[model samples]
Target: MEAAPPAPPRPWPAALAIGALAQTLFSWRVTIPHQLVFDEVHYVPAARALRALTAPANSEHPLIGKLLIAVGIQLFGDHPLGWRALSTVAGTAVVMGVFAILWLGTRQLRPAVVGALLTILNFTVFVQARIAMLDGFMAAFVVLGVAAMLWSMRAHGAAMWRRWIGAAVLLGLAVACKWTAAPYVAAAAGAFLVLRHRRADRWPGMNPAFAIGVLAGVSIATYFVTFAPAFFYAAEPLTWAQLVPFQLDMYRLQTQILPPHTYQSSWSTWPLDLRPIWYLYEPADGAQRGILMIGNPVVLWGGLIAVCACAIGWVRTRDTASGASAMLWLFSIAIWAAIPKSLGFFYYFYLSSIWLPIALAIAFDRFGRRLRYGDEAFVLLSAVLFVHFYPILAATALPGPQAFTRWTWFDSWR
Candidate 1:
């Protein structure tokens, strides 16, 4: 008979809606502890300062992140929901971006859905989204930039140029959110150059030099525009002449060794999940609550294997997408390792760990098709693990000390 008519393609609208709704539900919570948690203590006040056009409170990073947080506070008032609203939206956008990337890369809905789910359920993404931190905003922009670049690879002529511009803008905004995102911006530019070289024959009208210039120009312009308000609104109102030195001061602050931290971890231990920071832990109202900044073990451990597999696959087949992703992921790790900093924490891995879900998606797309129900099984296992770990992630009360102990799989985790 008639081969079932190819199962009638899944609607993009429906997939996007599902992904957005799931991420919103997962991240936006009304009952999330009202008291400022973790880095929220620093960022929330910075955002308030931004809203008031007062002196810059936290100059360690650029102002775009606080500006976004300020927008939330302006619209929603000063509270947890207000402080975290923009991050919640950014977190949802990240899921959408992952879906868009997989959809554009593989031209398949199943892989895109799986990738979105993986990102949505990532413990770091979930935790960061609920707090007023810069990571979620930077991550959202980074993913959008990556998706735009991937989409551009599959397009031609005007469509391709437009996508490149979009990628540059998003990546620039990412850097504006956090200077640490600079490497990702560089990675995107590098990927574009390589892709253009490989596809030179296909686009006869495209000028590589002009395209590179446009990308660089757009990125630099976007970064400066994002910083313009900072120069205007701060109490001192820094002039253009002073901006360069100001940024150097920020870099110095970042690299200098601060007072020792109890929860600090080396880059080496991040992949192994050796040390997790407890963002909050309080015993009140006859129950204990906490928000531990940790990765889901299943995704972290499994994604590591997937990244390795992608590397091997690239070596054997030279798959451009897999090779680009692997290189970017490795570059993220390498930059951190190369930096001479003694005060880094496990949270800094947020920039690198973004690739894990994408790598996992690639692995599933490439090999899972061979096994019966492989993708389905993998997604189910991740969801189950998310549920198993939700109590700790959400900071809900545990049954007792044993319940908390059971969740800590390793001594280092404890």
Candidate 2:
């Protein structure tokens, strides 16, 4: 009974193929623009400071994301590639992570590929990953946590507990990148209990109290450990006594109200694609370069309807994989509506963006079976739309000004 999980037919071969392809897309001319884009202004410098043992620049966010950026700069030298190399890696990891979630949860190959490909060709992951930002690292680790959590409960093995602990540690790593990872920790813990509960106490480590405690304790401890480097900083070296107070300071900064910006958006508008952030739109290197953080219309907008279908399928069939996908998308976005953070942006939906493909794939696989490979056709449609908007998404050379309007179907996107 405990071995019901399909451990056979390893998903890695297909998942690795997807990762390799995604790597190529993520790294192609990733060093363009010859300078930082968007919030790279904040983080690249922060990374450099941390590398030099100076004061952390963006102290409001956690240190691991910047630490990775520091590692990239250390390996590649402080340039565009240095600033963005790890982001590309993290971004590619995200696409691969999405594939793993779908494949592991559903044990379906084609649907996994379709979902991952659609996510890769979208606007948010590509743009955010190519730039020096925390979302890429945050999103990547969240996926890793979800994948590990899924594997821990379902697969029967001596090391199941290790995988579960790894999931919590990864969640800590995600929050160490940004506070946005907090919700995912809860989601992962919740998922662990739910999956194990369905199987009763047949397994050896099915103790609910211990499971929750391990998740909570391990993740909190890991989050605290990430601040170790701060204690050694040459400038304003932090002591253990200051750690809790420092975290409180960061919390205050995160929730503080700030003057509104042109692109600031509410949580409700995210699914509607009403607000798009143009991270970079300036003439550079003899051509106009524009990189907009917007969702793929065919994938992002269509995904909402598909998510609803996934919810219905979950309730009727108790499809854990499909249900998990729906919950991830919902919890990721809905938390913003309830969070104390007053200011939000289109890119804040990056986590939700990650789950859309999984939800879409599950829905298409379940509901579109009647249409015969309808999921493939939907993926193809997403690819075509991706091609149509490649220039805007990839910071490519545009024909001229107002060319952005060609893809701006809605006035709000402008």
Candidate 3:
């Protein structure tokens, strides 16, 4: 029998600790080298363009992510700190959001803490957060929406409706940041429809037509409002007459076939992490430093098995937590396989990768107590791997010329 978790306590205390620890780690050496790394060249300049209201750069992606980056730049000026401050904040939000989502979904405390820890120890999330990137912002809002949706699903009456509205707004911001958020948005809407149709016993006035209409109208309005800033661009400013044409241009650019990249890996290979990207590996800060965007070997590899186990757990018990982990892992990766992009990269797996720790934590919550300290052991192993890989993952200066060789144990990773 699955062990019943004690009722969850207030989330604020845990959220505070997680936020503090994650913020400290994520902000460490973020200003090192004072130059753009990898995609920062594209995004940072695009953010600058947005801030200046000049000719737009990187128009293929939506504006909110860049606009958020621009806000950091506007406040802090165009330095490494300004460029990446919001990203660091977003990363911390992701960690706290994961904990809250787990708590709300499972009504369990242990799983929430473990999931947040694994998120902190995950190699890719850490690296991505410290950079000037859109994924971090999108991910933060995505989790917020998920947490809100979970709360809405579990609430009764008036509380349920308010949470639903909150979910819609957060999801709207997520979609405005990236189209990748669509699958989760769809999942939330689907859940609402099913619950209202067959399971909303405690909900009041939960008519299907009314609920669907509200969600659709609110989310769509939220998405469209993000584009309002585009109209204010000073150079060849976008006009009302050209709005539809602008969207078409963005679509055309996003779908156009591009030359394959050296670091590009197939979507199939992302879950196993068969390939990894070296965002930086050169002399920086007066020594050889590097940043490898890879998964934590212990947690990421174990997560695959845990995800399959979650599928089985759901089959046996129909536990919402188990089902959610399995479902999210499946959709997050599967969506990439179905996307029309001509090429894909390991980094694109960020969405899927975020689910691994959650899957593992749910497994621990449901079955791991058969072995004492099983969950703690798993977290320990993951943290060890994180430490071993930190030098490469954080662009920390290497100890010797041979250090890089040791870190790049896999020839393909080179």
Best by TM-score: 2
For candidate 1, lDDT tens digit of each residue in 301-409? 8888888878888899888657765676788889888877877788888867777888888887775568777777877888898888888888787676556676778
Pairs with backbone N, CA or C atoms under 3 Å apart (clashes), candidate 3: none
How high is the lDDT of residue 223 in model 2? 93
Overlapping backbone residue pairs in candidate 2 total 0
> In candidate 3, what are the lDDT values of residues 6-81, reduced to their tens digit?
6658777877888899999999988875789999999999999999888768988888999999999999989999
- Segments in model 2 whose C-alpha atoms lie over 4 Å from true places: 1-10, 201-204
Model 2, range 362-397, lDDT digits (tens) per residue? 898888789887887888888898888888888889
- Candidates 2 and 3 compared by TM-score, better number: 2
Worst 10 residues of 1 by lDDT: 22-31
TM-score of each: 0.93, 0.96, 0.95
Better-scoring candidate (lDDT), 1 or 2: 2
How many clashing residue pairs are found in candidate 3? 0
